[model samples]
Target chain A: MKTLIVVSHPEFQDSITQAFLKTSQAGLDDVTWHCLDEIYGSDPIDIQAERELLNGADRIIFQFPLYWYSAPASLKIWEDDVLSRAYTYASEEGHLKDKELGIVTSVGYPKSAFAAGASQSFSISQIMIPYEALAKQAGMKFMKPLVIAQFGYSTDEEKSQLLVDYQMYLTAKYPFSFNERETWMIQQLKKLASGNMKNHQQELDLIIQELETGQDDLNDLKEQINLIRNKEED
Target chain B: MKTLIVVSHPEFQDSITQAFLKTSQAGLDDVTWHCLDEIYGSDPIDIQAERELLNGADRIIFQFPLYWYSAPASLKIWEDDVLSRAYTYASEEGHLKDKELGIVTSVGYPKSAFAAGASQSFSISQIMIPYEALAKQAGMKFMKPLVIAQFGYSTDEEKSQLLVDYQMYLTAKYPFSFNERETWMIQQLKKLASGNMKNHQQELDLIIQELETGQDDLNDLKEQINLIRNKEED
Candidate 1:
């Protein structure tokens, strides 16, 4: 599916979090990255052009650094000038119907800080009710938010893992569960093994066997969880 | 107290709800009304000047129509340009510390639409977590949001009542409770009775008595509620 990422960071060039995330989606042909500041810096925003970009995408992701628990001013302006005017009531049915609305936001604080008794005192989902409400109003499906917390403190290994996970979140199958990912990996390995790749066939076979075993273990754990829940009910 | 109302409506002149609210506070001294669009119409925001205005205010109110469950884009831009750079980290203690942050917003839908199983499917307070989070980060006291829902359908009587309530919200005591308002009204009546107002002394006295009776009734209701809770525990 074609994906559009509308990035809204005041200092986009200076943001290490955004820069690193951008690198994660590198060489992805189906992804269109549009920076708000670069496109409409200090100028009157072209609403038509923005609507055109929205029309061309199957999935639209609002990517930004969380400023005071919301997007920076640039994104708000874009929403007012472009989205509200064009998408809300301009037509009989809204322009953004059936499209998937997603958010990929990075917060300065750790994820643990956002809880009832924690420093933030509210979960990310609670704070993002405005977006959910907007999605409802526009007839779009609100996808679960992808939250990246404490990007500055992440180790190199974690960053590498994040790159893989972020890519999967953007372009992988819908619902993007662990089961789907495992199945995809196994399919790819089988395809490679079928080819004249005799050098890595043994290693690929071993990895495929490990993945199948892991899936079985996961199913067994799920059954155990269900049994425990039923026991508690009783 | 000096009150700064930073209004972020795109078309303030044409907005009936905002215009009516503005008339409610007409000729009020110590209230600075700054229209964001009129101040910086498609121009680069003057961050220093905006900071100066914020510093002068005892209470800062963000007044706007709730677009997509938050303020209009102009306000967000003002926040990014003015507040974040200057107020958030200019000093060890933030510039907005101890000052009150208030929201005066109007929504298109009825208040009933915002509930668990309702059309909006979330409370206004939930949708306003971003503002609360901002206030917490800035060390400012986040005032209870003054939500005006379905302004287009409100009757003249409702509008008049809103005018009184909205004024009290902006300039009354710190908490702005019903009890404080009752006390303020009684005090005003007593002061008027003390003056050479021979014609309305009896009417004023009756009004003062009614207010006192209303306060007594409210206290009695609270006591009954507490007693019922204790009984339930027993």
Candidate 2:
């Protein structure tokens, strides 16, 4: 599926986290990275062009840093201008109907600080109601948000896992069941084995083989459990 | 109490609701009506001057029509440019500490549409978490929001009640206990009697006298109930 990442950062060049995220998806196919401030740059947004971008994407991602517990004004300006009621309402034209809407927000505060009694005193889910409501009005599926909290404090291993998670969020199927993840992982490994990692092709192939064998074993175990339960019922 | 109403409406001139609200608060004392779009039209916000206005007010009201379940972009721009972290954090300078933050938002939908299973499926309180969280960070008291819904559908009596409620929201004491509302009403009526409404002076005076008598009788009844409770304890 084609994914569009609509990024809004006032100081995009100065942000290391943004840079890392930009680079992470650079090699991914069918993913469009559209940065608002970079393109508009204080000019009025071209509503037709913006709507075209939304129309082309199967999955739309609003990616930004959490400014004042919401997106920066540029994104809001875009929302106010481009998302016309006639085009957005489910009972009307509904251009965004049945599409997936996702949010990727990075915050400076620790994840633990977002709770009823914590320093932030509000969960990310609570703060994202506006977007969810928008999704509802447009008849879009609201995907679970990917909150990158205190990314600077994350360890190298954690960052590696985040990279995987971020890529999966963009392209992985809905619900992201374990089997779906395994299939996506194997495909990525096969691409890597044949592409830039030609020297490590043998090792990557072995790993892919092991994953496929594990999947087979899992299916066999499920069948055995179902058969035993059926016999007990009889 | 001094009130600074920072209003942000892109189409302020065309909005009948905004016009009605503006006229409602026209003769009120110690209330500064600051319209952001009119004052700073296409101009950058003067951060220091905006901070000074906020600093001067005992109560700060963010008045706007709800666009896409949040305030318009201009208000968010003002917030990002004006409320710098150094001056806003309660642990730091905390310039807004102990002040009250209020929201005055007009919505197009019916009020009943903002419940879990309703068409909107999100309460105004849930949608306003960002502003509430901002108040929490600034150590300000977040007042209950004044939501004006379907103003065009309101009857003349409903509109009159809205005027009084809006005035009370801006000027009345916090918690707005019945006694406090009564005192505020008496004060406002007295002001009207002495000022522009002097043509109905006798009638207004009689009404004021009747209200006072009713208040005194209620107080006496409360005292009698307390005395009886004390005797029961004995």
Candidate maximizing TM-score: 2
Q: Give the least accurate 10-residue stretch of model 2 chain B, judged by summed lDDT.
A: B175-184
Report the lDDT tens digits of candidate 1 across residue range A25-107: 87566898899988888787898899999988888999998887788888888888887635663243588887888999998
Please tell me which predicted candidate would have the highest DockQ against the true structure. 2
Judge candidate 2 at residue A170 and give its lDDT: 91
In model 1, where do residues sit more than 4 Å from their true spots?
A: A85-92, A186-234, B89-91, B187-234
Candidate 2 regions with alpha-carbon error over 4 angstroms: A223-234, B223-234
Question: Could you tell me the lDDT of residue B162 within candidate 1?
Answer: 96
lDDT of each: 0.84, 0.93
Candidate 1 lDDT over B1-234, as tens digits, reads: 889999998898899988888887775568888989888877879988988998899899999998878898888878877876355742454888888999999988899998988777789889889888878777789899999988889998998789878877777767877889887668757867878777999998998999899999999999999999999999
Model 1 complex DockQ against the native = 0.63
Look at candidate 1 and give me any clashing residue pairs: A73-B76
TM-score of each model's B chain?
0.81, 0.96
